[model samples]
Target: MSTPQPQTHQQAAPAPNWQSAPGTSYTSPIPITRTHLGHALTSEWTKIKSVRSTMWTLGVFLLLVVGIGLLVAANTDSNDYADVPYTIPAFFGLILGQICLITLGVLVVSSEYGTGMIRTTFTASPQRHRVLTAKLLIFFVVAFVVSAFAIGFVGLITSGMHGGASDNKWGGTVLMGALYVSLLGVLALAVGSMLRHSAGAITAMLGLVLVPAILPAFLMMSESLRTLGEKMTEYNAPNALAKIFELDSENGGGGSQLVLLVGVTAAAIAGAYALLERRDV
Candidate 1:
């Protein structure tokens, strides 16, 4: 006969405080949530506002747009606005101010690539398209709002001093001008993303903006290209802005300008997205 088997005591398992969902083996102690575009937007907003370039560029932009506008308004008389909208003076200021916005837009994406911060950005947010979308949205909104405010403020002052014509659609015209400027900035952003370099993208955008306006002049010298040159002059950025502000005599071209800009921006954005996915950060 064998010695009495050693006795063992077994403890009962604790009861579950909460039942796990079907097929879930564990529950996370920390809250788990899916990320969305809103999160990307918040991140982009934080990055953009924290950067010094954004502040500096926008400050110079405001100064140029507002200061030049005031100077032009101060020098002109009520008779100057008799046929044009009170918002016309804003066009002159915005002509120079747009350069600042375009620079800022290029810097938004290119700066990250310059500093290797884009890798970290992508690591934190794996969705590349979302990041690009956020950049586009943030840059567009800031540019549009600032442009509109500066231009609108100038229009208000000029209108107050010179008395706008009763037929002038001051609000609509000013908004349209702001929209055109914002589109230019957005296009610059797309170029920045595609090129991934600040200087190159800035130069390219400057050329795009100024070249069309000037190249058309030279192209007009050749009888063969005079038609194409005329079309370029009609649709170039400066001409578009002038028309939007009612400074140009042309009518019904505003829609065409908007369509052209919108189409170009869209194509640039699409190309940027395609490159961003394929290129190494």
Candidate 2:
């Protein structure tokens, strides 16, 4: 061997330790927080409040409720309420205002579908059921609160204008009416979710709210059909609210109307949940 065979040098190979060892767990550098119903509620609240449809719908609701309420109160003499509950005047505005609530309810979910925002909503929160539940809760609460305030304000004004004719039942009647309308709005949301289209859902709800009331009038030609139509008229949305207001013919009373609405709304919500779970975004 050449005496000074160029000093050979060998470097040790690096150990294969960069990979995780067997049975060892790896932690991510990123942090994640668990989401809950509260988050969904917040998201829904923000979405509902930020939309122009909400403003326009609710604005018209307020105008109709307050404007018509005052007008009715101003035109009628307090003595006229001797036989009727003072809260009856609020009915004029609430009947029309309910349309606004229904429109807003449809827009709440249908608008998102129309704009394709639902895809992002599901992407962010894959638990579709939770998202839908949150929407229902938030919308019901908002609708109830706004309606209550409007009805209360109208009742107060009517009472002041006709104190002697006012009845203590005004509170209960107003609360019941508010509940009825809120349920209708919730039903509208469910329909919107099921249809996934704004115009279609709105039309469906309009029919739900209106057709039952009018159909009976035309069906009076047949006795058997008239009976069914009469029942529909008695239990229809407007008549239900009117019963709560103590203005309509007292067939089933407000209690029966509330029960019917609750049943219908519950069924719709269940169907909505089922459809939402099975369908693709």
Q: Model 1 TM-score?
A: 0.89
Best TM-score among the predictions, by candidate number: 2
Clashes of each: 0, 0
Candidate 2, 44-77: lDDT as tens digits: 9999999989889989998999899999999999
Please provide, for model 1 over 1-281, each residue's C-alpha lDDT reduced to its tens digit, 9 standing for 90 to 100: 88999999999999877876788897579997899999999999999999999999999999998999999999999878767777777888899999999999999999999999999999989999999999999999999999999999998999888766445668887678888999999999999999999999999999999999999888999999999999999998888888787777566637789889999999999999999999889
- TM-score for each of the candidates: 0.89, 0.90
